[model samples]
Every structure is written in C-alpha cells, then in structure tokens.
Target: MDATDGRLEAATVRARVATRENIARMNRSERAASALWPVPLAFGLAAILVARVTAVIDSRDALGIRGEFLIRDPDTALQLASVVASGMLVFLGIVFSTTLVAIQLAGSQYSPRAVRIFLRLRLTKVALGVFVATFVFAVAVLGEIRTKSGSDFTPTASLTVLVLLMVATVVTFLVFASGTARLLRIQYLVERIADEARPVFRDAFTRAQEVQADRPAPATATRVCTNRSPGVLDAVDVADLADAAAAAEGWIDVVAPVGGYVATGAPLAVVHGGGGGGGGDDRDGDQDVAIRRCFLLSNERTMLEDPAFGLRQLVDVAIRGLSPAVNDPTTAVQVIDRITDLLGGIADRPDPPEWYVDAAGTARVRMRGDTFDDLLRLGYVEIIRYGAGAPQVVRRLHAAFGSLSALGDARHHASIAAMGALLDAAVADAMPAPFSDLSGHPDPRGLG
Candidate 1:
C-alpha cells in the first residue's frame, strides 16, 4: 500500500510538471526564474550526465592522450573530486543563506514586493545552477573512481571540466553579488519597477476612441463563476476572449479587474446572448472552459501586460518612505521622478481602444484599464496625502502635475488639474503657511 501511494505521488508530480495549465502564466520566461530548484536541478543532471559520457571516452585506449594527463593515481583523483564536491556544496549553502538575509533586509527597508526583483534575476539563478552543476559533476566523477574498475580508471578530462566549472562558479558568484547589491538600493529598485512599465504605458497609449461603455448584465445574463483555483486576476487574454465571444455570437464583460483579488466561486465574467446552439457548447463545459482559460490568475499580479502594477509598486515605496518610522523624504522624491517620467511618456500616447469588437463592428468584449486619471490617482494619491507635511514631496507633486498638464493631450488636463488641486489643498492644510505657498510652485527638484 505504501509503495502504491508513493508511485501515485510520483506520477502526480510528473503530471503537474509536464502540464502547463496547472499554473497560470507558466508560459512567461520570468516566471521560471522565481523557482529556485528547476534550473539548478536541470544543470546538476546535465553536468553529471556529461561527466559520465566523457568517462567512457577517457577509458578508451584509442584516445592515446587520455591517461597521460592529470593525476594517474585513482585514490588522489577520488580525493580531489570529493574535496571539490564537498566544498561546492558548502559554498552553495553559504551563498543562499547570505542571499536570504539580503532579501529579508531589503523587504523590510523597502516594499515587500521588492523581493521579487532578487528572485527574478536570471543571473543569480544561472550562477546558482552552475554551482550546483559543479558540485554534482564532481560527486559523480568521484563515484566513478570508487565503483568502476577500482584503482584502474582515472577520467582526467572529467576532472579538468569540474575544475573549470568551479572557477566559473567563483566568477559567477562575484557577478551575482555585485548585481544583488545594486538591486537592493532604493533608487535601482524603484527605477527598475518604473522601467518595466515605460514601454507598456507608451505602447498602450492611444487617442481616446469611441468607447462603448459596459451595459448592465441582465438578470438573464449567464454568469461565469470561477472554478476552485482562486487568486489575483493577473491577466486576461482580451483577444482570445473577444474571439470566443464573437464565435459564440455573444458578449463578455470581464467584471473582475486585472490585479484585483478573485475568490473561488466568484464571478469571473458575465456572458450575454449565446449558447443555445453556439459558443463551443457542441461539447459539455466547452464555453465555460474557454472562458476560464482566457483568465490567468495567480497568487500575485504580474506586469506581463498590466502597466498599473508598475505604478502600484512605486507608490508603495513612496508611501513607505513617507511613513514616520522610515521618514526618508528623499526616497519619496526619487520615486516621484520616476512617476513623472513614466506618466509623461504615457501622456504622449493616444487612448487605447476601449471596446474589443468583431468583424461586424459588434462589441464582443468589455474590460477596464487604467486611464491617465486612474494612473495618476494610483501613482500620486497616497504620495500627496502622505507627503503633504513634507514640502519636498508637495513641491515634487506640483512639478509632476505641471509637467503632465504641459506634456499630455488636452483630454488629460482635467485629471492632471484635479490632482494638482489635491496637492495644493494637501500642502496648504499640512504645511506651514510660507512653505505651503512655496511648495505650490512647480519645481522638478522638489526643493528648487
């Protein structure tokens, strides 16, 4: 019974690993970097396998130059391999422990989401993978010396490769450390988050088109509720949903906003007009399955296509910097610089298409996105409210709003103006009279 259960567990693990659908957003390459084991595990297996194959060549008498290199004695060769393997294992333990300490300190000092920056670094992952591979290869080589034709075989080529891997791992560790140190700094952390969304905001920018606002879902509308896997609505494939609805001769409104929390059995979307004989219902559960597949939910939101997440993280850092305990207004000021540039770039873009339509010009899908006002609010609301007491923060907000009003289309002026009013009021109410008056003037330097 125990053996059967173990086999079943093993089979389940394999199936989960092989199936992409089990985890949403697995198609994204960045997602792979977050997992610590997979890369290192693959490297370890490949390294050992390469060493084993090379051993076969080393054993061949036809290769006249094989045994004429490195240690000829099996015991000395085994000892060297053992030492390298053990040393590498110890080295990996120390490196990861130090990394966790860094991550912990960064999270406490900055925002919690800052930890993802470290985990998502492929450089660190690759370096760790090389370390693991070096260790595994050495160990595997050591085993060959002990078990295979004892005292007779010494795979010199395999040992040389192991030594090379060790040297490479050492170099990789230095690079990883330097990169990690840079990422830990507040300026780098916020800028990176801001940079990830620059292209998103720029590319998605567009002139406001004829947006067909969402109509209320009728009582008769078919509600599409989520199945067991509950998480944040990270992303929705708008094109696919539009296509599915068009095919079904129906309309879909994804009620839950991307980046919002979704509970199990909660409404994922509402469908109107379809499925008596349409919308993939030729088979049971087809329409629902199609609808569910278009949504990629996970424990947290990703910036894959969501530009607002960038604003979200930046605002978080700025707000934390404003907190009394971490009252580092300079960090808040730096954050505003990024917010201004990001919003400025977005201000130049035309409005995105609000409605996803089919060939016949019918509205097939309705979903919400952050407008300039929305982005402005998400990026600045808290900063203004919290930073009001600080003249530097208030001054920066004044400048940011002024820049946006100047750089963006006339349509964005109203929103920018409203935010400016809020900033004006916040400073007037929070700061001393003279400082409040001075802070109102646009100063990109926040103090200047």
Candidate 2:
C-alpha cells in the first residue's frame, strides 16, 4: 500500500484494539451497559420490521381485532416503532463512533484532518438520514393533524413543535460541522509545516560589526593555531591570507584562539574597514581587518562528512602550499602536516570503547590501565594523537617541547629532520598524496 493508506489503516487498527481493551477494563456497571447496547438495537430493528408488516395488513383491514380486545391502529403503531428503532440505532452509533475517535486521537500519527474528515463524512450521512426522516415525519404529522373549518386549516401546536425540533437539529449539525472543519484545518497546518521561530546567525555578526564601528578603535591580537578542515579550497585560501598577514605584518587579524578549533575555508580574521584592508596600510587598519576575519572564520562549517579532520589537519592544509620564496621554508611545516594526518588516521581507526574529556577538555582516548602511560613514555601520544613526532628517547617530550606554539619555535633541526622523514613514510602509507611532493609554486601576493 501507499504511505498514506498504510498509515491510515495502521492507525485505525490501533485505535480499534485500544478501544476494545479500554472497554474490557470498564467497571461492572459500564460493562453491563455496554452489553445491553446490542440487545436493544436488535430488538428495536425486529420491532420496527414487525410493526411495518402489521401496519400494511391492518391498513388493508386484512387483520380483524377480536371482540373484548383493544383495537390498535397499525399506522400509529408503525410510526412509534420506527422512531424508537431509529433513535436506538443513532444513539449506539454516536457512542461507538465517539469512542473510536477518542482512541485515534490518543495514538501516534494522530492526524486531526484524518479524524475530522472521517467524522464529517459520517456526520453528513447522519444529517441526510435525519433530514429525510424529519421530512417524512413532518408530512405525516401535517396530514394527521390537519382540520378543515369552512375551507381554512391551521397547523396544530404539536406540529409547530415538531418543526422547531427539526430546525434545532439542523442548526446544531451546521454549527458542529463548521467548528470541526476550522479546528481540523488549523491542526493540519501545525502538524505538517509550521516554521520554528529562531534568530538568524547573520544578525550576530552584524551586531558585532556595529559595535566595532561605534568604537574609534578595537583591541586586536593575532595568534595562529591549528586549522580544522583541510578539504575545502576556500579554507586553504583563508589560511594563506592569515599566514601572509602574520609573516609580513608580525600579526594577523584573526588567529585560532588557544585551544580553539578552526574549520575549513573559514576566514582567519575580520578586517574592520571595507571587505579587506589596503596594502601597505597602517597597523590599526591591518589589525582591525585581521581580527575581524578571525571572528568571521570562527564559525567554520561543521564537517558532517568527515568527523576525523580536526584542528591539526586543518592547519596542515592551510600551510600546505607555504612559500618556497621565503628565506627559511620550515620543513617542520610539511613534516608536522603529514605526521598529523598519519597519527590522526591511526588514532581514529581503533575504537576507544570508552573515552573521557581531560581537565583541559581535550578528548583523551582511554587505554586499559598503564598502556597510555607507556605510550606517552614512548612519545606515542605526540606521534599518534597530536602528530608531533618528536624523538621518543627525549623523556617528557611534551615538557621539553612545551606548547605547540613553543614546539614550532624550537631550534632543533636534527629532530625536525628526523620527524619529517618518518612522517613522509607514514603519511605515504596513510594518505593517497605524499607531503614532500605537495610543494608547488604558490601564487604571488598570497593568493594561494
């Protein structure tokens, strides 16, 4: 079946079962009442049928009443029997239908439109039946009550009362249907496609810009941290901009805050004036743009596709096409990038089973007992986790190396070269692309 049909059938079946269960749980009085319902309905129908047949026979004068017995007119008897039977049927239908509706409303996938439509269709059928019955009864009443006084006749009070009852029933039906229709329409809209109210992200940036604009000068600082996404071209470009700004001007507008993560293609800083500050500009203008770019880039696009590409790989990609034109092209840059990728792969490959956030809030993968300590002593944490790849013999390489920032600044060419060679082989094994071969002529004017 189609989705809509499947849903409707499932819902109806669920409602029916639940209603039956509820009936089973009812009190003794309720159970007795429920049991009595069908008996009256069946009796009513049988009485109606017998009365109809008796009426025809008596109206034709085929059945004669014996002497000493009350002579009952068949027409009157038939009318009364029909009304009783119909009323009983209507009452039972309403009770059962109402219970069913209530059950459907309680279940999951309770579409008010579906409920309303069903109710409306059934109610409409009932209205038609009531209308026809009322018309027939009105005609019969008029015929039976009519009296001629010199060719003029007036409706009896009873006839007037019957007409009023019909009007009231019609009015009630119309009012109920209208209210239900409106309610269902509202419920349908709410269930299907209501928009959630929330603030737009752009407003926050606009407000920040407004605040900066109001001030004569805004405090700015540039600190480079790891980049988070290495895949997107835009992120690499932004990183290139930040690096050039930092190298040329001794600072960048935006840099990774310590312990903060950078996403791919996100701008490193927010320049205050215009889209970008002018070349050969003063420190104030450059710093403003750089700092603003930093904020702008802070909200890196979340990598839903690749959760493993974190801050370190992002920095590597940004610095991937670093200038061969510079005096000291840090091999450490290439080495660190490749090593980070390799170690990140290894760390990500094995499931930790259970891990915890350290005091610094960095996620530390758990090991069974002192395996983690042994790995640290072997400099495996730096190699496998951070991809630092410093010498294993140097106990407490972390303390000796200091922070990533300090480690980047260390004057040890021997360890750096060794790390670079080892990282090259590891990276080759892990990645499709080799890091040493990644070098190419970068675009002039920091375009790369």
Candidate 3:
C-alpha cells in the first residue's frame, strides 16, 4: 500500500480500538464485573501465599521470642478459622442475594434504567469483595493448620490477617446497608441520574474549533454503506469516518441519527464520490468496511454517545409516576425539576458541530447529533402528555419552562413557549376547569 493508504489504515485501526473501548466503558454490567471480580481472585491467591509463608516461619521458630505472638494451640486456631471461613461464605451468599433482590425490586418499582445506578455503586462492590476476601483468607489459613505428630504448626500471622479481614468485612457490611438504604429513596435516584448525565451533556455538546460547517454531499454519490446488523446506533467514530473519507477522496453523510435504531441493510452512511467498483474489489470493499466500523451499533442506548438516553431515563421515571397505577404526582414533579436542570445546561452551551473536517480544511464527515430543541422535546413532551390531567404536574412543568426561558436564549425561549402552549392545550382539554387559571402564565414557583 502507498504511504497515504498506510496512514489511513493505521488511523482506522486506532479508531476501531477507541470505539470498542468507548462501548465497554459505557457498559455498566461489564464495568462492574471488571472492577468487582478481580478483588476476590487476588485476595484468594494472596491468602494462600501468606498462609504458606506463615506456616514455614512458625515451623522453623523464626520469630524466636516473638513466637509468643502466635496463637498457642494449632488445633484451636484451625477450628476457629474454619468456622469463620464457613460463616463468611454464608454471609457472602446473603449479601449477594440481597443485592440482586434490591436490583430486581428497583427495576420493577422504578425505571429499569435507574438500575444501572445501583450496579455502578462502588460501596456495594467493595462490600462484596471484602466478604469474599475474608472467606478466602480464613480458608487459606485453615488449610495451613497441621496436626501430625511432627508437623503440628500454627499460622499465627495468617490468623492475625484473618481477624483483620473479618473486622473489615463487618465495617463494609454496615456501610453497604446504609448506602443501599439511601439509594432506594426516589430523591436520591433522581439526583444520581442527573449527576451522571450532566457531564455527558456537556461533553456531547461541547464545541470543537476544528469542526467546519457542514457541506452537503454530492447528489451523484453512488456508494451507500448499509448496516449489516440491526441495533441502536450507540456512537459514531466521526474522526475515523473522516479519515476514511479523506483517504477515498469522498465525503460521508451520516444517515442514521445517534441513539436511533437502524435495521440490516438500511442506509447507515452515504459515501459520495468514491469511484464505484464491484463487490469483490479489495479497494472499495475495504473502504466500505472501514466506514461501517465507524458506526458502533448496540442492543441498547448508552449515555456516552446519546445524551438523550439520560433524558429518556428521567422521563420514564416521571411517566411511570404519573401512570394510573402509581399516581405519584410529587415524584413526577421532582423528575421535572431534574429535567429542567438538564435542559438549562443544554441551552447554555453552543450546539456541537455536525460536520467534521480533516487537517486540510475540507469537510469529510457529517454526523447526526441531537440539538437543544430535540432534548427539550425529549425531556418534557412525553411527561406532559402523560400527566396532562394532573394540575400539579402541569404547574411544575410550566415553572420549569419559565426557568429555562429565563436563561435568555431565544431558541430556548421559543421551544419552552411552544411546549407551554401544548401543555396549556392539553390541560384545557383534559381538565377544562383548571384551564382558566393555568393559561399561558409563567409560574416560576409553580403554584407556591
């Protein structure tokens, strides 16, 4: 391959790796497992090493006068260690079962997406690790106890370590219980989701100086890249797509929006001006594959690439609260408060550029990203539609719009005013009696 071709190939490889890493990082289950599983494994191995070393030292009388620090009876030490290990194993089972039950209950009682918050909790993972580690430590020490005529030995140091582990496990269990209780509160869940989503919104919408204005692709574009798998378009590696387009001397117009689903054979991206070739040709075929790799498809939406997914989660909670089965208007109002904060953050930032340009100042890729208006709609419209009959929900939503409008962005004001009109209409239609009082007025405090 020529130097230019080699450069493009290298760039594509880097892009592919980065894309996979991004997806893995966004996957909550994979992240939790990666972080939580190694704790027990490492602890188990460490326990065995410590046990063997302590056994050797005790047998050799290496401590000499310090032998007084060792537990006097090997048999008693072994029995106690075994009991602690077995008891810890049982406790580990209980903690695991309780955590799973909590997750299941949270999923059923609240939005399923909110369950990710629990999965990502650090305290729970640490508590689990401590329990497993304590059990492993005790078992390892127990194995070192020898009762033979000439081989009787006590792993004094190992026993000491086991005692420490037991204490740590107890403390961790208490903290875990307390944290879980706090997490179960609805207010905590709402705040947690908002906290996680704020930085994502900022990152997704942050303007890049290198991004050029979007240029329309040529009408004669013959090469259309289709998705081979059907799933949500989680993210697009725009830089990689741009590199590939630059290499092929073409521009790629992204057809599918981020967070939207694309079916197999649907147009994922349209490549303009890359000369057409038969399917078997390596040059065109490789370029097609390169472009396809830039679009990361997944079974579900992720906050890493789709800021709207966060809004969707919050909205789901609100809508569920508004449902006839759970008419918790207070919860719905709290959700709106968070939604307003997210929307306000979006309104304050400049729109992220849709077009990516290569170093030569040519636009190589066009991406489909969510706009502030799109977020506004996603954040409020569904909740309003579901809660139209509830005066409290309507009032809170009106106050949210007023707060968003106060940010002084004309576009934001316009979107909020339009939504306010819709809510007014919906409320009038749903509860005609309240229409006279709730009509078109900006209530910053919502009926206070």
Predicted candidate 1 versus true structure: per-residue lDDT over 1-448, tens digit per residue: 1245345222111000001132354436546767777888899889978987878777774456666766777788888888998888887987798679877976888888777777776777787889899888898888677435644777777776877887898898888888878887889888888878887786456443343333323335464645447888777776677777877667787788877888877778877767642233234366777778888877777776578888888888899999999999989999999999998987865555545655444567767677777888999999989999998888778888888988998988888899888887888788999877777777788785
Q: Candidate 2: deviation at residue 90, Å?
A: 23
lDDT of each: 0.75, 0.31, 0.75
Better of 2 and 3 by lDDT: 3
lDDT order, best first, reads 1, 3, 2
TM for every model, in the order presented, reads: 0.84, 0.19, 0.86
Could you tell me the lDDT of residue 355 within candidate 2?
20
lDDT of 2 by residue, 196-260 (tens): 10011111111121110111122253232233343231121223333433333332233332223
Question: Candidate 3 regions off by >4 Å?
Answer: 1-66, 210-219, 276-284, 432-448
Task: Point out the worst 10-residue segment of candidate 3 by lDDT.
Answer: 10-19
RMSD of each: 11.6, 30.5, 6.7
Relative to the true structure, candidate 2 reaches a TM of 0.19
